[model samples]
Target: MAVAPSTAARSIELPAALADWLATHADALDTSPALASEVVPRLAGAGLFGAGVPEALGGSGGDVRDAIEAIAAVAERSLTAAFVFWGHRTFIEYVLQSPNQALRERWLAPLLQGEIGGATGLSNAMKFLSGIESLQITATPLASEQGGWRLDGGLAWITNLRKEGFIAAAAVTSSEGAPPAVIAFRSDAGGTERSADLDLMALRGSNTAAVKLDGVHIGEADVITHDARAWLPAVRPAFLGMQCGMSIGLARASLGAAHRLCTVTRSGLLGRVESLQAELARAVGQMHEGVADGRFKSAAAPLFRLRISLADIVQQAVMLELQGSGGRAYLMNHDRNFARRWREAAFIPIVTPSLTQLQMELQKQAAAAGAA
Candidate 1:
């Protein structure tokens, strides 16, 4: 892994060859859903999917920082690819942290190698952890068998639901009123249906879809943890931290593009570009410090705030790029890069745990504290 200068906020960088691959294919991936579905295996072959995973888990050994930086590096070239990367790597994380050794052993290698895809159908689970929503899926006991569960309910939105093969992690409430649990179910399993990709304004290639589980059966072997209340807290830090990398990379790329323009025709915009660049570095620095010291694991509010800040910066950077490029960026030909980045910027605010949702959560927390 290439390391950035100490003064830089993030230390990790993808190899030039991998970076070039992402940049070269970014437009195609953005326009073609068929090509986008192939993103996991393509980047997996480049060894881009395993940065933060442990060697024992069949991954190149590193921590969450490495993972976040790797994703950010990819995002600089292609947010679509970065979105897919986040989904696949986040699932790898679930398996790594899961208590079930057999679950890890059975799935980790294939997931790590990118032979099969992994989906994180856990947006509701994260919200559920925050007390913002209930678990969307439910598990009922199997009267005929000891360790079987019947899952019903669905996720309205999920990414990386590849058509080839995939296993998704979801949280489920139980009919018996047992503590909520996290479980993995495969796509090929009966009664599990993935809808056609949602008609999206951007990220058309992300393989995003909605899924329904009629009576999907899962056994103890599928359980990531029997107590999601406990498991989610432990894993939530890495989860949101890695997710923030998407914003970091997009902001970096947009800022760099703006800076390039400012040097020649748009020198007046230089001050604004520098200000956003500095803010991006500071936000990244805060995230790295929190992840290293475990502050984000115990308290996610700070990370949530940081995620919001980065989203704001990403929007500003993309708009700045547009301003600097002016009429040239509006062209349908090669200069459409700015238009694509603009659409990607629009996605940052609405991604799961959206800016609005985070703002509401903060308000609720404050009101409760005031009452206390």
Candidate 2:
């Protein structure tokens, strides 16, 4: 069950009490799924879950920056919990800002209350657009059910499907002369089924899986956002916010490991770790500026550049750690988390609006500006 929202008008401040609690619980949350499951529950208990929901809907009505701070702090301790919180906030934001009031009242409130866990199902089509080309999902309308639609598609590599009550997204249809629209439904709503969890190289504890929608039924109330083109522009920044938090977490972990190594081993290799740390700091600063100035307009191109830089830093920092610590860093527990983070960082460049494509687009823009 979800905790009730606070009655008083509380300022949107990052409570030190919550931060201390998170730090105390960090090891348990990082090590155990049972403890990690308490993440949203604990957040709701602390009234953090209501951070993004509007006050009219029994929430504090905090802004994006507030949400960012909360998630970033959580990321520093547990990346899996941070991912879950980030997804919850982003989904709620979508529901609140959506033109569909009925949808907001129906899905958003319960979701915020932790009665339902939600995942965004946009990555399937996004992967297809990135030229993965072998999508196995389809959504078509059903004539038997009133104002109902049927979905028969499979989305591989979906996050939070195993534990969530439902996932949301736009589904491509056979309808002609009309733009595609978003559709969502409960994960166990009759015909809906999920594949076994995928053994991912990174974010191992995220409960990601391949979701198969086998003739799943959805009603008009499930439509979150109708405009397909407007979707990316609206939500890109919020998604980037989570990635920023993840990058910061990776950098912090790498730096901590490097510092530990420097204390025991003295060599020129320490200089390389210091240089990478400086580069990562500069990249993070630039990324923050781009996010602040709204340079990442849509399609995640500008943000992708920052992600690529962070990945490079992670790679270099990992090498420096190995050099500074000798062969012991390769042991199972010593550097396992860092290795997973590095693999996850590598995956950032391959997702939607891929880095290669973004580079070409950037080149065209630069050439045009140069000519002008």
Candidate 3:
């Protein structure tokens, strides 16, 4: 990726009013684990959710790249908060891009207005559609009496979901040769089951939980888009690309902590730490370039490699923080919350197109090249 433009940061800048608020509240946000429903209104007041939405739909109207920067900023403050932003943005993208004009008109405004926050099942759905995993959730045609479609089975687990909110769900039809579909539903809808939050190893503050749909009803207006076999490839790149912002922000924060420790200790490892800083700088530059130019659709290998590299870098960054900080990091509330960043590192690899998945995919590509 090209070195960040001199003014490139302007692209991801948060609205002025919001930035002012964040400067004041950044510390509290980093330490606490408040519920999203409590915080979403705050996000709305800042006009934060509309970054990627169309002006006509009450969004501020930037593409995915703009949204990525905005979310990344949130990540630096709180990765949990960033996940909420991404989930909302992801759901909005599905709705706005769908052929369902009526659905877009009905929910798009309120969604951006922060009246609602939602969850995404896209990660697992994409995996199932791509044949990496069996479908955990399945869809069935509705009976004439019930109308609309029925969604059955449970989504394994999804982050950024609220106890009561909207959900953008996708599932493959359990029919031979049938394509998968993306649909919307209320989390509290009839026959839908929302489980308690999982005891996650990381991102526990993200309000993650399991959702089971036992013939949940969805109307024609709720079908965000179908033909998942055809649609997923078109959207996967952007979906994955947007994740880079979060990684960059987390990496930057981790590195900063390491710097603080190194400063106090005046350690010899400063050179090694500086190398990580250089590596992250290079990765962030390349990520933004690839994402802005939509290169993941073509030369995605570089993008994948960079994404995994960031994951690895965050681990090293946190390790440096721990080494430099010494016993202080073991405290329950270390000044920098270095422990949280350490936990945050666990999330990147397991996320879809996870490190293992990335390596496996690369192996497959290598095999294909040899055959060719």
User: Which structure among the candidates has the greatest lDDT?
Assistant: 1
Question: Given candidate 3, what's the lDDT at residue 18?
Answer: 59
- Give the candidates in order of lDDT, highest first: 1, 3, 2
Cα TM-score of candidate 1: 0.96
| Candidate 2 lDDT by residue in tens digits, 8-78 | 22223446666676656554444444453555666666666676456788776655545555565566555
Residue-level lDDT tens digits of model 1 in 234-294: 8887888999999999999999999999999899999999999999999998998888789
Winning model by TM-score: 1
* Per-residue lDDT of model 3, residues 228-314, tens digit only: 766766676667766766787787787887786787794776887898999988877777677667777666577678878888888
User: Candidate 2 — which pairs collide?
Assistant: 137-153, 137-154, 138-153, 170-182
Q: Give the C-alpha lDDT of model 1.
A: 0.87
- Which residue pairs of candidate 3 clash? 1-286
Off by over 4 Å in 1: 1-9
TM-scores, one per candidate: 0.96, 0.76, 0.88
The deviation in Å at residue 239 for candidate 2 is: 2.0
Cα error, residue 99 of model 3, in Å, equals 2.4
